[model samples]
Target chain A: MDEMDNQFVTSLKENYQIVFQEIGLLEQAFTHSSYVNEHRNMALSDNERLEFLGDAVLELLVSQYLYRKFPEIPEGKLTKLRASMVREDSLAEFARECGFDQYIRLGKGEENSGGRQRNSLLCDLFESFLGALYLDQELEAVNQFLKKVVFPKVDAGAFSHEMDHKTKLQEVLQRAGDVFIDYRLTNEEGPAHERVFWTEVYCDGQLIGRGQGKSKKAAEQDAAANALRQLNE
Target chain B: MDEMDNQFVTSLKENYQIVFQEIGLLEQAFTHSSYVNEHRNMALSDNERLEFLGDAVLELLVSQYLYRKFPEIPEGKLTKLRASMVREDSLAEFARECGFDQYIRLGKGEENSGGRQRNSLLCDLFESFLGALYLDQELEAVNQFLKKVVFPKVDAGAFSHEMDHKTKLQEVLQRAGDVFIDYRLTNEEGPAHERVFWTEVYCDGQLIGRGQGKSKKAAEQDAAANALRQLNE
Candidate 1:
């Protein structure tokens, strides 16, 4: 039997409660580029391809879940919710919770470099695993896995901060209706290449907050952020 | 009987060969917000919810097809490929080919504004229809529908240009092996708020192309475009 026919399949079954009919897919999902590079004689592809597929699946599931859960929310707000849920940091946290890091098969160099502890590595691995799972058993099995692991965090308000401050501020203001909120450039300095910009955000005619940044867009974002903070207080 | 149960369902069955068991889903897919707003007493919802669902379904289907078809392409390239395929323009073209615009239920105001002819509206309609199809009939039917309508265009070389020029140029250079590509900021001008930046793209220590744009990133993209055009020539 191949490497995948043994401990790999058993461990997936035992730990994750995942049973793979196409065990090779499960194995490939755990196999990193580093591992494949180190093991040239063995025929094994890396998880990057699977990671690609998994990322889409994960996004769709999260998006669907959010859409159903937040019936009253608009598309833009729903987008932010999805983004926060699927962002690198949250996916990495999900990976850590699932112990997906421990299962990652890396080259000796990457393994020695503490690849397992790295959030990026773990996040990619989680995505890769999900991709493989989707292929092996399709969406039903994948949904079960996510329901057991990921969705509960939504109820705990863990993702509340993940929403963009500017968007949140706008949503709050827009719901109140017909309020003119404007961001104006107040100051500009430094060289053209490394320019600094200061912006003031006004609610009606009163300056609510001021902020500075390296670009006009950045400055506006900072100003909005400041306004959000002040308004919240 | 509802509007969908009458000629709408008959036409879908006749034209698209799509016999939706849950015909209500197919109806809602084409039902615009304007229709729901105009007919407030009618227990009809707009297609936005299905549009959201369909967008994800379309993405997943496209991703799966690409993954299986192109075994040699890297994930990044696959992502670019997917982006090109699902982009509003391409999807709008797909909608036009499918004649989705003809069946869309729009508000009278929107309809008078030539909404059906609008690419964005048609594209959303196509996605909403697909979303509704997935809900009613599932993946097999969706796959069959796409095979008959979508995948043929892919083979006719319709999708070849959707991938970014920079990545294409890089891929070409990389295929030749051990080549260095560098994008340099050649010049910066105009005001900080409306900056015009020039960039030069270098391949293997030689400048291949130069371009200017409003932002550094845009300038680099222009430079990359120039390089690709030069390389093609």
Candidate 2:
């Protein structure tokens, strides 16, 4: 490796505490599909594969951290918390914070279009980075890296950053002394084993929003979520 | 504790190496919602709360374990695998295997209906079990228990299974020397940032199944899943 490349590797190690046995894994994590399409036969794969693996690992680590930190919260609350934390926007923010944009190799057109700063791209790269970390070092190393970096945010309630619409709506209704908010199942279909239900949420006899899910309970939750969104709007 | 209860606790500790610090926690884990409903003034909480916490803990633990074990698999694949391993069916099976069915306190009606063997009920109880463990000991202890018991089936590749209908349809068509398989994007809606897609999958020029999802990719997967089901039928 040249002096500049050596500095890049050293800097990454210093920042992430990850030593890339196959630097190609790291490179692959940063190489977007646009970059690969532009350079046909360049003998480099896109980061999609790595991103796919990293997404799971990141989710697992984050979920585990939350469960350990909060013993009092229920599953529904935990699911919502985890969803907020691992959502695309949060992943993108983490990617930008890690300074992955500069290292990401994108096609000229994508670069021109500011693809490096795109939330979707950043999220993909973040996942790809996890994939690379898992392959290059192993689970322990990946766990260590996440614990040092990601776990702190989870501990500080970084994932539950926003008050969900449902909670907000409930507060609004309760404060108004209205308890007429009801969610009713409108329709259902599919086999008994995997039925899907459509639900509509109403407040004070006024319809607000509709939602669908694999179960009546899930559909009701979705309806509540939609109502929350409408209230926010 | 009564003689039967003491014996049950003793047997659990002797056989499973699990010593519950708060016996009430373990008792609560086995207390079904039916029981709570029937005996409204029992001053005992239902297992729903525990199930919720346990679900998160299980997912996190499974994700971490899988990441360490199969460092090569991508996140999407790993997520699917983890989902399969930790789904209601698997957890219910684990509950039954652990003799949880015998101890679960159910209502008379539920007991008559053989709720002990019901996957949904079993799964909920299993989550409660995890919740009890988490509250009684710690996250590490719960992880250790899971690793020794439930996680092994997954690790042993007992439930490592896959089926792709899109691929199957394509294969059947190719083998039959026909080009009758088609997938069409029927509708797209929602915000541009979080657009959802609807798709229809056809085989031999016949509309076989339909699906909807958050993205074209997910819609395609749903379509494929539906198509596979139709083929199986």
Candidate 3:
């Protein structure tokens, strides 16, 4: 590794408080799958697995912090808050703030296509970074990283009761008319263990929107969310 | 108020070590919107707020616990495990086991319709219960409740890598000899803040599924997930 790479590794250890025996894992965490596929001989590992791990750690830490901070919010609202906090856009923004774009390894094609700047990819790298941190330093270190990085970014204003989508949707739709929202099951397929549903939203008689999910209800909610956004816009 | 109620309350405090002051919050946690709407006179306090609080608390505790217990597992696997463990179904099951159903204050209509037995409602109540626990007791108390009621049910065997439909669909389609899954955008309308998109999945020149979401990408993913499920079936 070059001096800059060594310096970067040292800085990460100082920030996350864990020294990695295999800086390879750190490299892997920052490596996009695009990079791995491009260089077949390098035996490069992708960050997808690490990102997945980091996502959980980040969620837990954020969830706990929010719970402690706001004792009055409900589960639905909390879920939304967590969702908002950890969404791809937010995570990507965090990655950018942390200078993740500089460290991530990308294939020439990906680099040409601006893959390093993509929110989805950046978000994945952030998760991978967390995963790498957890792997090297342990959970406590990951927790510390989350506390320092992700928690502060969670908007306090957005999480309050008034800002909740379901609530907002309910209030806005109720004021419009006696319109009842129904989620009709348009289609269903797959095994009994893991079924998926396609649902459409009907507002009065108009077919407003459609959504799909692992279950009928999840699809319906997604449809409702879509409809709500449409109506608001 | 009655003998059964008094005994239940007493047992709750005795067994759980959560004081009655906190139990009051727990009782409130089981109150759903259905119950609140039914009893207009009471202007009832619902479990939504508590559920929100509890959700955050639950995530943190589970994350911390999983982090401590599984050292060898990478972050991605740990995240999936934690998500699987703390999802709605698990929370609802835990609520039922904690005797949360018996304490719920449902409207006569909801009660007659068997609201207490509903898993969805139970999940909310359980979240609210956690919220109340956080407020009435302490973080330690809430952690204790989670350890006793929620942790055991999360068998690692049930945890699947392909839990998310979007990821599953992507993998499935990629393996099915299709490089580009065509998403036909039917419509997109709304403001910058809340935009909705309607899209259809086209594979081999056939529209397989339709979906809608706040963003085009989400809608496309939904369609892809639906298409994947249908293919599997």
The candidate maximizing lDDT is 1
TM-score of chain B of 1: 0.67
lDDT of 1 by residue, B94-210 (tens): 888866777778889999999888878888888888888887887678878888888767655467676566656665676546688899997998878988999999998999999
Write one digit per residue (lDDT tens) for candidate 3, span A1-233: 77767777877767756577778888888788888899889876788766666776676667667665544455566677778888899889889887888888888999999898899999888888887887777667777777677765553233334344334444455554566656689899999899999999776778877888898768876787787779868
In DockQ, how does model 3 score against the reference complex?
0.22
Provide the overall lDDT of each model, using Cα atoms, as 2-decimal numbers. 0.80, 0.76, 0.72
Q: Which residue pairs overlap in candidate 2's backbone?
A: A51-A128, A52-B75, A53-B74, A53-B75
**lDDT for residue A29 in candidate 3, whole number 0-100:** 88
Candidate 1 global lDDT: 0.80
Candidate 2, residue A184: CA error in Å?
31
- Writing each residue's lDDT as its tens digit, candidate 2 over B1-233 gives 66767777987888789999899998888889889889998777778767766776676667667666654454566667778888889889888887888888899999999998899999999888987897788667888888778777754446545324454445434543556667899999989999999999877678878989998868877887787667668
The estimated TM-scores of all candidates read 0.66, 0.54, 0.53
What TM-score would candidate 1 get against the native? 0.66
Model 2 lDDT at residue A170: 54
Residue A19 lDDT in model 3?
A: 74
Q: By TM-score, rank the candidates, best first.
A: 1, 2, 3
True contacts kept of each: 0.50, 0.32, 0.47
The pairs that clash in candidate 1 are none
